[model samples]
Target: MNALLQQLQDKQLIWLANQTEAPYEHCQSTGFPALDQLLGGGWPQHNVVELQSHGACAELQLISKALNHSGSELLQVWINPPAHLCAEYLLQQKRPLHQLIQLNTHRAADALWAAELCLKSGCCIDVLLWQNSLQLTQLKRLQLAAAQGQSQLYLFRPLQTGQQLLPWTLSLQLMPASTGLQIRILKRKGGWQQQDLLLPWAELYPQFIKPELQQRHSSYPPLSRVS
Candidate 1:
């Protein structure tokens, strides 16, 4: 009887595996080997990703390489960025500034409206929105918009604000490490990641500031003071 139950479980597991979609089919390589491996190849396209971090800039550094590789035809849109995007830094990394569209809004509602428009228009392949708090219903709306336009949507929020469940294809918690960034995969489609992955900062941001200086300046002030 025990042997019979074990056989049934084995067949069930195989069936589940076959039913699941392979990660590489839908993911875009994040440009980091360790991260790519952890994410089952890369970030999922046509989905909403939630990035939580103490410092808003940390998320930017994590995705800079992917953004740079977006090509000329598709524009990278930034809605209410936390800090001024340093043109010199982008130049250093060889990311084309002309390919970026930045929009500033005084209210979160406006930012959400603009992000939805950008995602639904099919004009941009990547949209980054820095909004600290969003309702679950609002996130669902954005997720649907991303799916409709086949665009990758990244939403940045403070670590403290991500305690609630959200409708995200991939959700990650980024913390600063001595050598690089420590990524904790909070939620994903297939399975939960038990271990945190360390991605060297130099690989993505060769000109990253020293660990000591980065720590000294990395603090989340009030969102009102961000601009």
Candidate 2:
């Protein structure tokens, strides 16, 4: 039993509850200062980060900073995007169009297969995969693939299975807010369950913020004067 447990730990299949700090050696900034702080510096590299939402909730903008941070050197693969990705939006955000590649697979299995391949290729910086649901076993495979290639996978999923605890390096729920995304950190490498953090897009990305909330900040009284 002892030997088996050690093997599981060595394979990263078992994580002790008290273990804190990211298991990975490196992490990249998520772009938002508040988010970076919440994530303990940035998104952990060589791991799967699961992002869940009810529907389209400006999730792409959430990772826009990371994309820009990676630069145009390596490939950034998108597997099974719901709709045509906007080249203009990516360009405006400073993400290199030259490095971005979108792959459309005939089936979901094919998409996951492609994602694993991209992650293990060692030439891709990041892989963004959109799938309706994922089995825990499948996540483990992706996680291993990412670690092998020293890459990151930003996975998008529906909100239905958000409550279930999984083995992902990080899990978050992106709720749409008037100003931007109300992000809830479901899980992380450090095992810290953070509170819901509001990333005001109006302040960061003015173009994506709702019109009503654009002036909400200005209308507030000065901070020191509040009694």
Candidate 3:
């Protein structure tokens, strides 16, 4: 039994809770120092990461760095995005515009179908799916497809559904903040749930974090770049 357990550990199939092990080999960097540290190096490859947000809260900006790092050869597919992605913004972020693919599936069923097809195609580096509703069975199917194709999937959902923990490799909740974005780690493969982490964005993206008129009685100061 000891030898078998040792072999499984060597093969990366099993891990001890106390062992300092990375989630998976060759994890992708999120480009946020605090987030990267929280995710045990970076986002695990070939796994689904569920990102939940109430409304427009800089969620795309959170993963823009990882998408930019994805090579130009393999495609970065987006299915049922909240809105039409701006080409100029992609260019501004240094993303490979030529490798980007967007699919507008009006129906929920069609959106899932399109997402599954893209994830199982093996030609895509990563797939972004904006879906408000999903089931445990659907998530499991997508997870298997992702592993088969060796691609990553980012499923965007409404904040309400984030309360029920599912089988996603990782899950995060994004909330708008006065300074930047508040990130909560809802679920992680080898990590415990954590408190809200405020990531100040003025230093990283000045254009996104605008200066607003400060309210005298407000709890926090207006968000602005210190420099």
Candidate 4:
């Protein structure tokens, strides 16, 4: 009996010890339920997640949620959104700049570099990267940084059509929804491939979307197939 007790103690197989395992720190949401469900309960603490899209395809809710820091935690957010976007309108949509550490630059490359640095620093909950286009090299670098720091990085690409699996835990392809955005997990951690995940802005706020059907102009050009 004494030997058995010593073996059990060596393994530390007590209930109290089991309870002491570190809980997975999740990236907070913008209070949106739909989006949260798509990415397996939001961004996780120890992996890299990429968001790829273009042509009005963005993840504003996700961004807002990531910046919604708590526990007196200061999370940094680096953005290089398209120039056409109205920062004022964006501010109106998402208020309170107290928890944000944003860097608004015209060059997407610069913004991505900044995001990689922040992720490696491990000072922020997770790094969010967004831009019109993303290069393969840049993404690989970011992944390495995230791994080195043991931090989660969220990469968003505004315009990408083809699909190529990289060394990422999750790859979410976002589409613009009438209310908010649809988050489709193209590649999920643990080899889970799910279909279209839709989340509306109305889920987070009291906004109504009225889809206006307009006649397609002759020169409107052929619609590029949305993947």
Candidate 5:
């Protein structure tokens, strides 16, 4: 044990104590192996993942996958999902409704506050903030709160502009592919490789399919949104 500690100290002297054998918490997966491969094993428990997309549906699918993957296990998921933002679709994903903390805040500032409060608590491991109407101050405050909590954050913002400015551990911009969607890792940390990967729609939701089923769906859903 001493030797192991000594080696870890030598390799990660600055973070040795913090990283020392603390039960190896599994990261929350986005339910796509290809995308999970892009973001190391999965999205780290204590980091921010930026989902900069042009539309709302893409971000919704990604966030739902993460929530379903974690699902009453190692971490709980809290989402500031306003009423106008398609809550029925989220429930239709078939994840546990009870485990989800659904907040109904219309104002962007209120939503940001709820998100920050959820993050600050160590109880919640993952949070998804749907920010289609957030201002500059709201974004900065959310960023600061996320940083302070040291918890995993998924910020979904609709940015139809040229590009996005990323300030998180991982930045993913997903585009429409011929059949499915193309996910690109615009920013990353650690040993993550592969800037771009093709993630099929079928791959994102494996639970909906029967485990013993051999056939695969032939048609892809109509391309309604891209980010």
Candidate 6:
């Protein structure tokens, strides 16, 4: 009888090992090779990623490539975006405008509510939310909801908020640079990266800057030359 019980336990362990998926297998590429290396392949699915930056533009640039590469069937929802998203810009980047949805609200509470609902609904595979501040408790709630919906949740907050310990699958800080954006990984599931990566802003969106701005900033060194 003891031998029979041991055999059953061994079989169960083997079955569990076969059913579990490797962590890297669940990641989706961020479209930037350097960024992918830092993230251990790509962004983890069914997790909440927090991006803090001075302006929403930097965060948008970071994820623009991923959005453009995403499938047409996957909906990308934006909640309380900082500024008006130009349709022409998205189209030029090869992002399907039809798959993009935006929900605007002035109140923070309303914005949070809408974002949580969208994450829990499972109607969208990717959800982007921009808000002023959120308590750790509130963030945890959203994190659980995101896990349940199996959605990729991105929360954008102002850099002024500083750093705080929170339950996030990944967290990053975006600093504007003359060449592009400097990304610092604050927290990640498996490990932490101390070094910062400079991703050329122009690589993600060629037409983002106006002709006048480009001419004025042309003297600045390019991203590759930085550091």
Which candidate ranks first by lDDT, i.e. highest? 2
**Where is model 2 poorest over a 10-residue stretch in terms of lDDT?**
208-217
Give lDDT: candidate 2, residue 178. Answer: 72
RMSD to truth, every model: 7.4, 7.4, 6.0, 9.2, 8.8, 7.9
Q: For candidate 2, what is the TM-score?
A: 0.80
Report the Cα lDDT for residue 189, model 5. 47
Encode model 4's per-residue lDDT on 69-121: one tens digit a residue.
43235464556544544567547745435555667866767787787878788
What is candidate 5's lDDT per residue for 1-227, written digit by digit as tens? 99988888788654633343322144676666776666666766665667767663355676666666553543454465544544566568665556666667767677777787877776665687767754546556666665676566787766446554444456677787655677777766444357578766556545564545626654777577654
Q: How much is the lDDT of residue 151 in candidate 5?
A: 62
- Give one digit per residue, the lDDT tens place, for model 3 in 98-197: 7888988769989888888888999998899989888998999899889988888999988864367586678888887877788888878767666678
Question: What TM-score fits each model?
Answer: 0.77, 0.80, 0.80, 0.60, 0.62, 0.75
> Which residue segments of model 1 deviate by more than 4 Å?
1-25, 208-227
Error of 5 at 210 (Å): 10
Clashing pairs in 3: none
TM-score of 4: 0.60
Ranking by lDDT: 2, 3, 1, 6, 5, 4
Better of 2 and 5 by TM-score: 2
Estimate, for each residue in 176-224, the C-alpha lDDT of model 1 and write its tens digit.
8877788998888765556898876666565655544654653666688
Model 5 misplacement above 4 A = 1-26, 56-58, 63-65, 69-95, 133-150, 160-163, 190-193, 205-227
Candidate 2 Cα misplacement greater than 4 A, ranges: 1-18, 22-24, 208-213, 216-227
Weakest 10 consecutive residues, lDDT, candidate 6?
13-22
lDDT by residue for model 2 over 1-227, one digit each (tens)? 99999999999999677676565578788777898888888888778998998767778777777877773688999998889989887778777787899999988999999999999999998999999878888899999999999888999988865367577788888888775689888877665667789987665566756668557456576899778
The clash count of every prediction, one per candidate, is 0, 0, 0, 6, 2, 0
